[model samples]
Target: MKRPELVCPAGTPAALRTAVDAGADAVYCGFQNATNARNFPGLNFTPAEMEQGVAYAHARGAKVLLAVNSFPTAGRFDLWREAVDAGARFGVDALIVADIGVAAYAAEAHPDLRLHLSVQAAASSPEAIRYYVREFGVRRVVLPRILTVSEIKDVKKEIPCEIETFIFGNHGLMVEGRCSLTNYVTGLSTNMDGVCSPAAQVHYDKEADGSVATRLGDFTIDRFGAGEQAGYPTICKGRYHAAGREDAYYAFEEPISLNLATLLPQLMAAGVEAFKIEGRQRSRAYVRQVVGAFRGAVDQVLAGEDPELADLVALTEGQKQTQGAAGSKKWR
Candidate 1:
């Protein structure tokens, strides 16, 4: 059995080091700008910091992937171009991108640099995957979380590029890189602006019933009872009343995390070249714990042993875990 690479998230320079030290085979990060999707405050790296981070990870035998994954707006392609250039100059092992124009730029400007298609592209079918690989020479494609295990196996049989899939983290049910719920409220784009449910617009109100209502802008997202834990106010995970339903229901998806530790062998057998862990906006402590846990799991699985699923419930979103679309289409 081929041992798949463990690709981990590194939002900050410190988290990059933490992931490497914890046994990550590759650390993926982005600059602190709109060129990447996770462009939030207190996360991402500066150009100088990325240079240092690449040096540190390379010295430790870990690869660094720079994410220039966000789609560039018209007349703003220079920003994405600069980000790709910076990644190449800083010695990133690969550039993960989604836009065709940006991919074209990278292919022409830095032909030797590796290019991996980002999940934000939402390219699930072999035809879509083949288009990018043929047009831009993409080395790998990060499959969206919406595919089943059987579908992944079929995709692998047809696609030429390597496949990477998210094994753990937020279970995104909405269309990748095409969300507009946040913009409806904050007027900022999740794909281009890289801010989802911006913290400045999030508000929580305490009610007389000892329940707390979470709001993003003027829209109430979800209300948690006294004993329940109130999750962050993201539009997709929010509870809403629609179609005459008085009780608020999850219009997009419930607040649950994807933990596929048990499916590691199945994924490898399905011809996945790498396993990605989400949560680039997470803390260093989270980076250490999640990376370390998955490191041990992958090593054990590679050695023909049964990997134990780590109790990552506390680290999960809304403190709940699910197999997500990988296990079933029941979520749809």
Candidate 2:
């Protein structure tokens, strides 16, 4: 089997170093502005940090991918432009971009810089993927998390560029590059503002009944019973009340993580060029553990052996993990 590149997450410069040391072939991060998703406070890198991060990764033979994936607002196209410019200036191996404008800017401004289509672009079909490849010269496309293994194999046969798939972390059930619930609730757009359920608007209240109520702004997203783990107040994972059902339930999707350690060989055989881990908001410890485990797993798979992954259950969202659509044919 061909060895796929192990692309890992790096929310901070520290995490970037950690990922590289732990054996990541590449690390993807964003600026500390609205230019990328995972724009939570206390995360991402500043200008100096980005340069240093690029230098650090390059010194160790690891590539750095800058994420300029968020859409630029009408009057604030400059921010996205600056981000793309800064990424090229800092010597990022590639710029992971979503918006057509941003991709165009990068392709025109820095023709030598490689471009990877972010999953946020939601380019699943061959035609959609080909548009980016044709228009902006995107070399690699991060496939959305919704495709099954067989479906991804079929896509690889038709698309011209390399394919990258999420092997671990957030299941991302929502439609990519198109989330507005946070904007409706907190005036912050996940697509444009690069934030979802912004931490400033998140609230957890201890109810009199000992259960906790997770609120995003004034809207109560979910209520967790005593001893139950209260999840982050993301709109898609929130439970809601309905008339037919007496109890509240996940109205959009449940909170679960994607773990694809068991499918490394299949992905490699399917022509996947890269395996991405999706947690830029997590800690350095999380980066180290996940990257290390996957690094060893990929190596074992390439050697024609079953990978013995350490138990990563404790790090998963809500202590749960699933193969999602990759292992099943009935995901909706």
Candidate 3:
């Protein structure tokens, strides 16, 4: 099987260097603005930092992909446009985008620069993938974490561009680029603002019964027993009280991360061109540990040995991991 490129996350310049040093073939990051998805505080890079990061990665034989993936607001398209231009000027290898207008602007302004469709686009089917390739000249696509391995194989048969799949980190259940629950409570859009449950609005309170109540804005999302692990307060993964159920239960999805280390071979054989790690909101230490483990795993697979599963359970949300839809629809 052809070895898939390891495309890792780099929230900051430090994370970028850590990823490259740990064995990433390409590291993807974004500016500290709404142009990208992981717009959390203390994450992402400034233009100067991005330029330096690109240089550092290039010197180590790794590429840098700038993520300008969030959809641009009607009147604020220029910000997204500027981000793409800056990425190209800074010598990034590619721009991962979702918005059609952003893609058009990149194609018109930076024709030679590579374009990768972000998972936020939700272009899973071959026809949808072909449309992006034919219209925007997209060279790669980060497939959404919603398809099965067999489905991915079928998609590869029809699409012309390289396929990238997330193999680790947050497993989102809602349709990417389309979540608005955060906006409902906190008035901040994940698609446009690049933040979900912005940290400033997150609150935790101890209840009289020894339970911890997680709140996003004024709304109590989930409550956990004293001994249970409390997850980050996000609307989608939050529990709710309904239908006479006193204990709030996960109304959308559980707090489980996706770990597909065991499926590396299957993904490669299914024509996946790259493997993506999805934790730009995490720490440099996390970037180093997870990237290093995956590096060893991918190298082992490439060397014809059994790939070892990375010990990333502690890094997962709620200390739970799943293969996600790639393994089975039973997760749904």
Q: TM-score for every candidate vs. truth?
A: 0.97, 0.98, 0.97
Please give the lDDT score at residue 138 for candidate 1.
98
Give me the displacement of residue 174 in model 1, in angstroms.
0.7
**Candidate 1 vs. truth: CA RMSD?**
1.2
Could you give candidate 3's per-residue lDDT for residues 268-319 as a string of tens digits? Answer: 8899999999989888899999999999998898898998876899999999
What global local distance difference test value does model 2 have? 0.92
Candidate 1 similarity to native, TM-score: 0.97
**The 10-residue segment with the lowest total lDDT in model 2:** 227-236
The TM-score leader among the candidates is 2
Write the candidate numbers in order of decreasing lDDT.
Answer: 2, 3, 1
How would you encode candidate 2's per-residue C-alpha lDDT over 249-278 as one tens digit per residue? 988877788999998888999999999999
How large an RMSD does model 2 have? 1.0
Task: Count the clashes in each prediction.
Answer: 0, 0, 0
Taking the tens digit of each residue's C-alpha lDDT, what string does model 1 give over 1-332?
88799999999999999999999999999999999988888889999999999999999999999999988889898899999999999999999999899999999999999999999999999999999999999999999999889999999999998999999998865889788889998998888888888888888899998999998988888999988865658989988888889887887888889999998989999999999999898999999999999999999998999997678999998898888888987855
Model 3 residue runs over 4 Å out of place are 208-210, 244-246
Query: Counting only residues 3 or more apart in sequence or on different chains, how many pairs clash (N, Cα, C under 3 Å) in candidate 2?
Result: 0
